[model samples]
Each structure stands twice: as structure tokens, then as C-alpha cells.
Target: MMMNHCGLLTERKEAVPLKSIEVQLEVKDHVATVVSTLNYENKEDKPIEAVFVFPLPGDAAVCHFSAQIGQKHIVAEVKDKQQAKEEYDHALSSGQQAFLLEGSEEISDIFSLKVGSLPPGESASIGLEYVTELAVQADDGLRFCLPAVLNPRYQPQGSESPSVQVTSVPASLVPYSLSFSVQVSSPHAISKVESSCSLEPLQYLNTDQTQATVKLAAGHKFDRDIELLIYYKDAHQPTAVVEAGQASAKPGSLMGDPVVMVSLYPEFPQSVMSSHTSCGEFVFLIDRSGSMGCRMNQKRPQETRISSARDTLLLLLKSLPMGCYFNIYSFGSTFEHIFPKSMEYNEMTMEEALRKVEKMKDDLGGTDILQPLQHIYSQPCIPSHPRQLFVFTDGEVGNTKEVIDLVKKNSGSHRCFSFGIGEGASSALINGIAKEGGGHAQFITGTDRMQPKVMQSLKFALQPSVEDISVSWDLPKGVSATILSPPITTLFQGQRSLIYAQLTGKSSETTEGSVTVKFSFEGHPSKNQLHFSLKPAEDSGLTVHRLAARTVICSLELEWKPNGQQNEEIKKKVVELSVQSGVSSFFTAFIAINKDSPESVQGPLRCRIIPTPLYRAYIDSQVRQCSGKIYCPPSGPLIVL
Candidate 1:
């Protein structure tokens, strides 16, 4: 069988259409830079346009995109999304070659790229570069993940926004090859690099132990997500990075200002840490939708998602602080509760919940989470013990913004700690709710230990978070700092708090810049100070400006909820911010058109599925005919909250 346009095997036993993928990643301190090249060829007899959807880390700042046909490389320029769309349509309808890269308006972590009109047997190479901050795990390891799987998200009936859809293809039918490597460097010495997947031994580049490199092993399949855990000699040291601004930008604008990112790991008072873990009304909400029956990973078939979820629930149930009130709720189309109200944590009640959890299956029908959340909010809050909500789910909701709004509204009464069970978890949902409601978010995937993040969230829930967090900067006269992000809100023990601010105007040559973050912890005031010279750091391709813009866009979107009176005004503000930053937002996308082709063309746009980055569960091809049937492929126990 011949290859199709998009890549998936369409006909009976067809060849995989995808060609090869090459990735290069470089990490400096806590920031990572990634460049990815994907080669695609059209083997069909007719010319066709290719549409491929892929996954990017939630916090990534995509800065560059280009398409190479033969020896010529065409770079893309950022523009207004609607305007870019018009240009792309006009060029394409007139038979011109156009490439468009658009971040999902609905989901932040998903991106769709369109390569226009490649004649039969023609090939094009696509290149992209992005920068993101590496998350420091609770175990003091810098975690970097290259997503490889994009699970099909399940939308509840009557969802306002149309859900983004994905098609699953068998791994055996996949026809592409992947090569990945990373170069790492930092001021502190690196102890070791770890991963669940195989990797080449570390290769040191410099005489000092600060720089090293690693690569994926030979004959490795592009199946699961590529995860690397980096351990540094000094894990918790506070560090600040000063990024240079764009030379072509206006001197006073955001792109022109040097941005500074500060990373800190707060040390809490031992007396307060012990005191805060004793009392709280803890609510655990679990998703029992049909999709929850899917396993956590493709490699391990016997570990169903529900079983792992049950295990996590058991562990959390046993760890609840004594004297604390707790309740268990599972929801699909409807919701089920173990007790009418939150019951105190005790041996009898805990045992009852555990037994119920053991017998629980993916019995609930649909992923309608709003009702359960509303019910929880309507219930009376128990006195003295603050309410802490824990949500576990493989996030697949279509009404993401609506859910986030609800959580934000009720945030005053409770803190939300969310866990995304497996790959394709909605970053917008998990991260948005946690940011709005004051709490933390954790994700458990294949080969991942849910204990570290789960225990960390419990620890944070028991302790009161740092309050009234504020950042202030001192610079030379005439030099001002515009904070790109909103103020700091939640600060958990052992977690890093990062801040980005644009340093505008000019500081005197002799003048030094400093920033201080102040907050009240354990009823005592605390402050962190960082001082640095005005000189710019090494050029990182304006990575900091893009990241700053991403931060601002997220902050603005979180604060800008569309309402009757301010709908158009808010949209206008977001568009303005997106265009100015040269960053694709919910309101903006990147599009480019090739004017070289002048002849009009006629052909169907062919789309074959390209697997998302991250290892995933095997897909079930047979569609279930009855509502009572649960079709689960062998996978790890995955349960989303």
C-alpha cells in the first residue's frame, strides 16, 4: 500500500506517511531551548495540503518557524490571526504555497500547522524553536518532558465551545523515525541525569563539570513521551537570569526592555510547617468518565487507569491529617458521594471510602464535571477548618473556560489542588484552576510516581500559603520596571516562585538593579532580594521577551473573563497585547504564504493523524454500540481529578 498525504495509514495495511523527526534541545540553568525539525513527503498521485496537530508544553514560548523546500528556507512572520488567515486563504485558493502555524484558540498546549499544496512525491521540511522553563521536581530534579501522545479529549454534551478532536493510530502502523538530544549547562555541577527511557551516557563538553550532553539511545522508538530528570549539585540555590531585549524594537516598548527572571525555593519555618497540617476540610473529586477506563501508558497493558486512581485515593485517604473533615465524590454525567457531607477523617470512615474505591469502575457515563463542582460549592463550609479541594482526572473537558471561571469565583472559600492523570491532560484546565483558586497542580503519567506530587500537594494544603506576595524593583533614575505578570499569589513550601519583569528605559552605567519579593509567612514578614549589574546576559535569541509575553498573555487571559458589558473591550485588549508581543495567543496566530506559485489548483485537503509527542495508551478501534459497555485498552491505572 502507498503512503497518504497526512501520515496515518488510511487504507488496509497502508504504509505510514510521516517521514522523520529530529530534535535538539539545550538547557542553560533552568531555561530550555528547543529546535524541532520534521520532514514530510506527499506520495499520493494528486497534490494535497497537509494538516498536522502536535503538542507543546503548556508554558512553552514558541519563537521561530520556517519551511524548507529543497535548498530554499522560508521564515514565517507573526501577524494578527484574522489578517493572517485572510492572506493564507487568498494565497491558497489562488494556488500558492502557504504555511500557517496557529496555537489553538481553545487549548493552549495544542498547535496546528498547515503546509499548503505539495505536488505528488514532493517533500518539505518544517522547523520550529521554542523556549520554556524547566520544572524543578519536589525531589530536587529539573524535569523536562517531550510530549509524544495526544489523547482524544472527551467533551460533555451541549458544551459551548467545539472540542478539539484527535484520531488514534496504532503504534505498529506508525511510519516515522525520531532522534532527540540535549545539551545541558549550569553554574553548579550536575550530579547525574535520569530518565525512564534509555539514553546515551553523559558527554562532558568543558573541562569544568558545568556542561554536558546526552542523547536518545540507538534504535529507540518514538512512542512514549521523552522525559529527562536533571539533578544539580546545588538544587535550591536562588538564581536570576537577565535577558537581553530586541535591538529592532522600540526603546520603550516591552520587547526593548531587558527582562529578568528570578527563581527561588522558599524555606518555611519548621514550627509553622508542623502546625498547618492538622486541620482542614479536604474534598476529593474523581472523574469516572468512560475515558478514565483507559490505561496510563501503552507499554504496560494490565495497569488500568481506574486501578492506579484507586491506589492514589487509598494513599491520600490514609495520609489525611487527623481531625480533618474529608469527603469522596466521583462524577461522570452525574456525581456520586460517599457521604452526604464531609466526614471527619477516621479509621472507620477511611476504610469505608477505601472499600468503595476498590469496587469502583468506570461506571459513570460522561465527563460532566460542572454539576459536581457546583454542588460542592453550594454546600456549607465547615467552621475553623479551611476547605481544600483535590481534583483527579484525565482532563478532557470542552468547557474549560467556564470551569475555570467557576473555580475562580469560589476560590475565596477553598484552595484547589488538581492532578492530571495521563498524557493529553488539558494544561489550560489544570493550570488555570490552580492559578485562579490558590493551589498547586500535579500530573501523573506513565512511569511517573504520583506519590511525590500528591504528597507535596497534601503538604501544601495542610500549611497556610504565603500571603500578600508583592515584588518591588529598585533601578537607576529614569529607568523603570513594568511588571509583565500579575502579582504573586500562592507560595508553597519547597516550590519555586518565579517572577518576570521588563526593565524599561536606561540605567546609569554605574547603577545596579535589584528586586525584592516580600510576603507574610507564618504571620512573620519575609523578603527575598536579588541584585545584578545592568549588563545584558548572553544573547538567547530574545527567548526572555517571548516568555515574558507568554506570561503576560496568560495573566491577562486569566483576568479577562468575557462579560456582557466588557466583551468587545476585553477582546480588543487581548489582540493588542498579542500583536505587540509577537506571540500567538488565543486571539493571534502565525501565518505565511508562498507567492511563487501563481496557477489555480483544485484538490481535496488530506489530513492523516500524526501522533502527539508523549507515550500513550493503545487506541480501541471498535466503537462501542451500547452505553453499558466499557471499552478499555490495556493501560495504567489513570484517574483524573
Candidate 2:
């Protein structure tokens, strides 16, 4: 038997062990801290081992994991991934209670948790906490998402699959319940908070409107991801936050030193913005995999992903400047191109492409984007015409790292604009390729109009590029700065650019510092500066420090080479940093063991897979329903965690 929910796959037909979940979210300005408590009970007659796989934001830093049974509580410790696995296995084999949580090696957003040796009739409460920076949307609203829908990733031939087999069932059949609430505070007055899921009225906690609280409306089925768009009074204003270091950590370390996070929204001159460039090459890549035939959302069952992509392509084709060059490519197991080379944009070529795009269907077998990308990069560039690549997909590819690395390798030749089509699209893949290629990434989900967002990116592509970007800091006499984030290579008008820096040495609380960002736009030089106080914010948690650490860790992970020596060194550094900062990484995991129980349980253990909810479209046609349960014949060997 096969069962699935939230990317979790189980091999047994027994009832799920998970019962309910409660979440608390606290937002301070642009960063958010989330804590989730999951309640589980083993009702079977024998001891069982339960495993669960789930999704999280790609950029989040998991800082805490703990478990409580009755009056006893156990806090997990971050350790090397291999070491943690060994310890967990030993505890399970010895009939002791243990818990382990680890991130996927291939995919950063997916994680697996194991509950070992849970005696029958026993109950446990698991706590998970993470911190992440919210992304700013085109309309200046900060976006916060709790990922609940994860579709199965399509692994290409000759690629090794991750330990978990991700599958899905209809959302209506999910047995678990969820409750969520949020407390938001910012320096600027809260304009409003909106969500794709139903939300209660926003209540102001203070007269100034700087503090507010909100909750998710009742009867929210886990059919789609929970997305919250938060708007502040002054959304585009440049701001800086300084957070103090951890007292228990060693000085001069990432966690021990104060970190400053600066948010910049660059403004271009009106003269340059008024004129859109007419001489550039635009390339569009569309995903035509079998899954593209699925409905975009449960709300709109008639509009499939392929149909939406087709409509968006029409808008893009119609909006292009007449003097520019463009082409279209669609891929699945195989790839095809509309033109042998990029053709000049004109009436004849535009109409020809439109006719072919309208005939496009989801006939492709699987999502294999690397081949078309490689072929695109192999072509020669058109002189005097910069290249901008627009990618449209549902983002179910498995080899995310390889695809992102390929884009980065050829980043100098072109800019990439990526769009994720549906709820379960891979954020890591969509954001990584765009970030590495120095362009923008957008997600279209839940009643969103694809044309507006695609056209916004088209406008960005038409805008003149920003060049000669540099960041400089003016600090107190004794203090020096070590930049943690990669240098800023791409900047768009009115887009947010985040910089993280570690402040070393000492300075008086009364001192002040300033940062200036200088860049060239359309052959004209311009700069923006923001002055901030040296004193760290009172009651500010280690959110900034953790975020900075995650930024650094991501950069280091990208630097990994296939050769042994460099890869080993990079792994060592990541493990050390991950352990020191208490942040989960690809090289490390969180493990907890209950030592209070003096005696081993006298029984053999059975393994139970905890079911999770997913969108109905995620399942393949081979799935059959019988007696209100979903089942599928094994496609391949089930790789248990």
C-alpha cells in the first residue's frame, strides 16, 4: 500500500500517528520567527516508529527542535549529519525513545523527521522553530508563506533519489487539524495583512497601529500553502536593524558578534525609467511536463497550468518591443524550439509564434529542464543585443543544484526571469536560478493573474540594467565590518536589496554609522545612503544573526566542487558553522534522545508512516481510490529513512 500527504509517503495501511498542529508566528519588521507544535499519539497495540516528511521556506534557518512527553522535555542538539544518524539508529535499536530531524541533501526545502520506539498509548508533543527574512513583493508587501503543499519531484534518469519517496493524496482526505495565529510589530504603522487562506480581522494592539494580531479563519483545509502579504505604511523606505550577539557563544564568531541587516530599495532617475529599451534578445522557456496538465488551483479546476502558461506567453509576445529579438522553447523529457535562432520581433514573426503557442499541449512526459538550458547557452549571442531568458514552469525538477549551477556558469551572457506556476512549485529552484542569473523571480498562485506578474518582469527586462554596483560602510573608529552576504551584482529600480554584515570590535552606543550604495544607471552615476545608530535594538532576538549565518552557509554550499579535497573542506566549514550557530544545514541535523527512561521496552517495533496532505493534481493517473482510501502499485523500491 502507498499513502501520501505533504510529500510524506508511507508503505503501510495503518492509521496515521499525527493528530493536530498549532503554530505561533511573530513578525518584527521584515523578519519572522515561527514556532510549531505537533501532537502525535501511538494508538496501536505495539511500539511503532513514525517518520514524517514536510516542506519549509528555502531560506529559513531552523534554530530549535524539542520534544515533550508528559512532564519531561528534551531539547535537540545540532550535530554532524552522519554522527546524528548513527546515534539515532543506536537508540532505536536499543529500544530507547529518540527523535531525529534532517534536511534533504538534494533539496533544501524538504526535511524528514523520525520518532523512534514510541510505546503504544504514549503521546508526545514536538516543537519546531525557525527564522527567515520575508521577501518583498512587486507591490511592496512583505510575503510570508508556510509551505503545506509539496508535489513529487521528477528525478531524471541516472540520478539518485533522496531517501524519502514523496507522494500525495487529495486534501479533503487529510485527518489532521491545524490552528495558526500571528503577532506583527513594525516601526511603521501596519497598513494591512492579507492571505490566500481566509483570515480574521486584523486587531490593533496599540493606538499608533505599529502592533497588531491576526488569526487564520476556522475550517481551512490544507489544500494550498498559507501565504500572507503584509503591507506597512512606508514599505519602500530604506531601513537597518542591529541585533546583539549571543552571550553564551564565543566572541568573534558569527553568533557572538553583532550583525547588522540593511534593506535598500534603489530608485532610478525618471528620465531613464521613462524609456524602455528596444534592442535586446528575449528567450522564453516553458515546461510541458505531464503535471502541467493539472489544474492551477482547486478554486479554478478548468484552468490548467499549460493553459495558463499559454495565455501568459501570449501577453509576453504581445508586449515585446518591436525592434527586439525573441524565441520560444518548450521542454519535458525532450525539448523543442520555435526558431532555429532568435528572430527579430515584428508583425510576421509574432503572429507565427502565437499560432504555434496556442497549439501547445501537456504532451511531454517528465520535467527535464537541463537539456534545453544547456542548448540555449550553447548558442552564440547577438551583438549589441543583451539576452534575457524568461522561464515558466510548475517547478517539479529533482536536480535543483545542477540546474542552478548551470545558470550561474553562464550568468554573464544572459539574465533569467523565472515564474513558478502553481502552489507546489519549488521555491528553491525558481529563486535560485533567478538569483544566480541576476534577474527577478515571481510566483503565481491562488487567484493570481499571470499576465500582470509576467508583464511586470517583462518591464524589468526592458528597463536599462544597473551596473558598477558597490557598497561602502562608514563605521566608528574601533569597529570594523566583515560582509557576510555575497556582493550585490544585480539591482532593479524599486527592488529590495538586503545586505548582512558582522560588526567586530567595540563602539560606544551613542555612535552612528552609514552605508552608501553606488551604481551606474544608463551611463549616469547615482548613490543612496542610510544612516543608522550603532546601538543594538533592545529585546531583539538572534534573528539577524541566524539569518546572516544562513546567508553565509548558502554561499559556502554553492562553492562546493565535485573534487574530493575542496568538497571535504567546504563540508567541514559548513558543519562547524552550522553547529556553532545552532542553524540546520545540509551537513548537519538535529537529534534528541530521551535518557530518563531507565528500562528498555519489551517489544518488537513496527514502522508507521505518518500521512500528510497534498493537492489532488500532484498524484499520477495510476493512483486509484477504493473505499475512500488512495493506493498505488509500487513504482520503485521505497527508500525508508
Q: How accurate locally, in lDDT, is each candidate?
A: 0.73, 0.82
User: Candidate 1's residue-wise lDDT over 354-456, tens digit each?
Assistant: 8998888876866778999999999999988889999988776667777888998998898998887765567678877887888988777753677887788
RMSD, candidate 1, Å: 4.6
Model 2 weakest 10-residue run by lDDT: 626-635
Backbone N/Cα/C clashes per model: 26, 4
Give the poorly placed runs of model 1, Cα more than 4 Å off. Answer: 1-17, 163-165, 274-277, 446-448, 562-564, 598-641
Predicted structure 1: clash tally: 26
Give the TM-score (vs. native) of candidate 1: 0.91
Q: Give model 2's clash tally.
A: 4
